[model samples]
Target: MDDPDSNAAQLASPSYRLPALDQDFLLGDSMRGVRFQLEFAKAEEVLRAWGIRTTLVVFGSARVREDGPGRHADWYAEARRFGKLASLRGGAMRDVGQVRDNVIATGGGPGIMEAANRGAADVGAPSIGFNITLPHEQEPNGWSTPGLTFRFHYFAMRKMHLAMRANGLVVFPGGFGTFDELFELLTLRQTDKAPPIPVVLVDETYWRTVIDFDAMVSHGLVSPSDLSLFRFADTAESAWQSLIDCCLKPHPPSDYVPVP
Candidate 1:
């Protein structure tokens, strides 16, 4: 005969567990807000714990390859060199009495993002990558500091994280995604939603050839002052100089404490 005690042991208790623990419930439409919060908080917690007070966000294409494409390879080289320069001089290497500032941050994918992260690595400074999950399968580049790599399912959350602690923006030649990130920051700066920070657009010929900002002013679409929001840099040193000239240098994190 079957053991009656075994039958009782086999019974499951659906009410014993919290509904929030259920993956199906968590993935449903009712839990979308919760998912967003999770995405934001997880990275926020990690970054905070890592002592990242501020960031210099680098926006660029993921398609560029070193020694494989046209002018893109040159762009990659410049981005990497600029990354190293920024990390070395932007207070990236934390000291006993000072907090790290303006650490290299990227979209956390291949191409220029990889170069920037690799550049930071060259100086052994920490870097960040805000990677977004795509339907087509994109992953974080290998160069970003391991613990600082974050994957975000929500683009809005990812964008928020990118802009929140940003002290400056370094944009390189790219396609639609790059344009979106650049314009998003520009729009924020124009509206005073984001404070004035140096926005350096690398490769003057590429930018001018792609979009005619001067024409936008000529057409009276945007005010003349809007044109002043961004400047062009042809090399790594010039990019660093532009940040200084624009008074966009980063400050220590608000919560930083001085060591005795």
Candidate 2:
């Protein structure tokens, strides 16, 4: 007869656990690559299931609130307006065939992200929020479609998801995080790694004050043509129009039935 203690010990052994059910094993350093792949696949699958074919990515400061000081109110209001305008005009309102294009996507936090998501909600359109885990926990804005909101621990994976299906990019005033996202996409465009998509920066005065693209050109830091990668707009309507001018083709009306 087998010893009961020995049998119990064997059953409780970590090695004997199923890999998929083993949290310690899954979260270990050796599984980092697997975690990255999981992050990519999970978001990809949900997005595909939702018929999100492409997105108009919005980047901005999470610090800007509608009631905040100075230009914050205007910026917030405009961002919200842009979200609604884009959704109404960009085929995100179409439920036919479950193929949504140019849906608004943001970082899934408060401030500008919340405003954009709220705008889409106001028009009864679904939007996406890609939240990330930070030292200070970031709560997802309530406006993003619950199923479409996601959280990622890996910045690279999050950035990958942001860039992969972008039809266009609209950047509002922001700080370091926003700049990181903006420049990454611009670099991709400049190097031909990403397809030429419309890039618009809202608030010409603010952008010019913050960065001297023309000076970069004169100093030979960047070629004169590189400055053409993005254009500036003072309002949400003009920003959208700039995208249209840059040949952002809105999805055409379709008669196909939604997938059940």
User: Against the true structure, whose TM-score is highest?
Assistant: 2
Model 1 CA deviation exceeding 4 Å by range? 1-16, 95-98, 250-260
Give the whole-model CA lDDT for all candidates, comma-separated. Answer: 0.87, 0.91
Worst lDDT run of 10 residues, candidate 1, spans 251-260
Candidate 2 clashing pairs, residues 3+ apart or interchain: none
RMSD of 2: 3.8
Residue-level lDDT of model 2, residues 84-105, one tens digit each, is 8888788798774678999999
- Candidate 2 error regions (>4 Å): 1-6, 252-260
Q: TM-score of the candidate numbered 2?
A: 0.95
